[model samples]
Target: MEHILHVTLPEATARAGKEIDQLTVIMDMQGLGLKHLSPSWLSLVGEAVTVIESNYPEVLGACFVINAPPLFSRLYSLVKPLLSKATQEKVQVLDSNYPETLLQHCDAESLPAVYGGSLIDPDGDPSCPSRICWAGPVPDSQINQSKQPHAPPPVIRVALSRSASAQSLGSSEQFSVVEVARGGQRDIPVGFLPVGVELSWCVVVFAKSFLSCL
Candidate 1:
């Protein structure tokens, strides 16, 4: 329910947009909603809804505006007309029974501890950490200082065969002979190969390498 917005574009802008769309679809399917629990609704700027509505309008299952002060009502009225009918319908203003309302839609195990859910007890449990929601922009200095270059993910190389046999040099017995029945395939485990590592080895040429298999 915590709506923590990070106002920074990722390095790969193209992929980030695609990922945002994917996350929107996923959240919509999961019946997740945004909980605006801020004391003041000033943080609910135009940019917040603009990105979501522009990219994946259907992603938002619901929007629960809770703990909004009386001042927010005027602002809300102004913005209500701006939003589409479908989006406006999804917004629920719950002045009281905030926890109970969220419980109706979400399981206790899934809800946060502060909202009467059993996710974790931050005080009693050492592993569980909790914090109050902060709706603000991260300082540019902090962002630049905390930034670190990301490394590419590891590549998993798989060699498939209908039937294959192998025997070590100077060994009498054949080792790692895997066979697959018709309309089926097998995954042969190759020992740990780290990232940026190239594996090259000679294998007995029992069958020609097929592009389809590769």
Candidate 2:
């Protein structure tokens, strides 16, 4: 899962890493491969991996990237050189031929029905007997509870400038949907300024190319 940027990663510590390592061992008993579908994998940004490696090093035993489209290969090549040898060895990229690979790691019954598994995909055909197979981390109480709709957050608009190698914006600027080509980077000023004012912000990615902070 892509982390909400505002939710800070836990500070790196030997104890925390040990706890995560223990959890990884438990997940190994039943398998915990991440089955990502195509197109969505394009949103797998470098910062996400950095967070994982920095705070929870060696937590993932394997990563099953399934059903990646042709363009995924180009993206992979662009990033392959940047990944460490160990990290590269842990990733298993699969194309349409993913069922067999998935079965090798995950049991058919535990797999999602949309991927030819016994369990129904939550977003699968509604006519199926058990379409809503998973409800995720939301508890049943919260799911069944009735709540009033909350007001939406206000949107901020900003002007952007294009330059070679990197894109930039003023500290006061806020923007969305600025596409920086593969291998390019951008710099935007952010965060608290009054020495120790305890500032916080959140980044929500509404689209593959869109990012907004509040």
Candidate 3:
């Protein structure tokens, strides 16, 4: 099956290594026919909805993360309805501010974990901006601990890049698809650090197969 890994980043967090980490994981998951999709907070404006609908036609479902600057609640309310019928029904949106809250509301078995941060460095430092730390197989213990009886295996982590040009650390050999969302109303500049930054937020996408892996 053809799988694609789509990454989205605001202008600010484009250089954050965490974004690369998330994308790597999503790309790895593509083997199972899973596609990862993310929309920028800046693109949550009125007209951008049509753009998303047209561009992401094959997106079976998506996981929305709010990691950038606060968006106008009105904008969030406005653009939500414009989602494609399929996307609206299958999409799962989450808030970076509250990972635990998002976890509690959704069935963990149905999603994959999406994690990223500006602190990670992809280079030798292991602490550079836009660095991807873990892209291959996840630890069995970690998988078992998160698994439940009846649900699918959850995605471990998916990353976002603020800009397509952000430096990417780690091997891109495994990634099949890399998505970038740029040119938006709010330009959030991401920080690139010599050392790794602390991970502040995460969005996990739960899928049925993920549970079987556990």
lDDT of each: 0.51, 0.49, 0.39
Candidate 1, residue 165: Cα displacement in angstroms equals 78
lDDT for 156 in candidate 1 is: 40
lDDT of 1 by residue, 7-105 (tens): 222322354454331111111111212334344543465556665566556656677776666655666676666577888888887755677877776
For lDDT, the strongest prediction is 1
lDDT of 2 by residue, 123-178 (tens): 56532447333423556776746677745544454333332112334344444324
- Report the poorest 10 consecutive residues by lDDT, candidate 1: 21-30
Stretch of 10 with least lDDT, candidate 3: 21-30
Q: Candidates 1 and 3: which is better by TM-score?
A: 1
Q: Would you estimate the TM-scores of all the predictions?
A: 0.40, 0.40, 0.28
Clashing residue pairs in candidate 1 are: none
For candidate 1, the TM-score is 0.40
Which segments of candidate 2 are over 4 A away from where they belong?
A: 1-44, 121-214
- Give the CA lDDT, 0 to 100, for residue 120 in model 1: 65
- The weakest ten consecutive residues by lDDT in model 2 span 21-30
Better-scoring candidate (lDDT), 1 or 3: 1
* Candidate 1 Cα deviation (angstroms), residue 150: 28
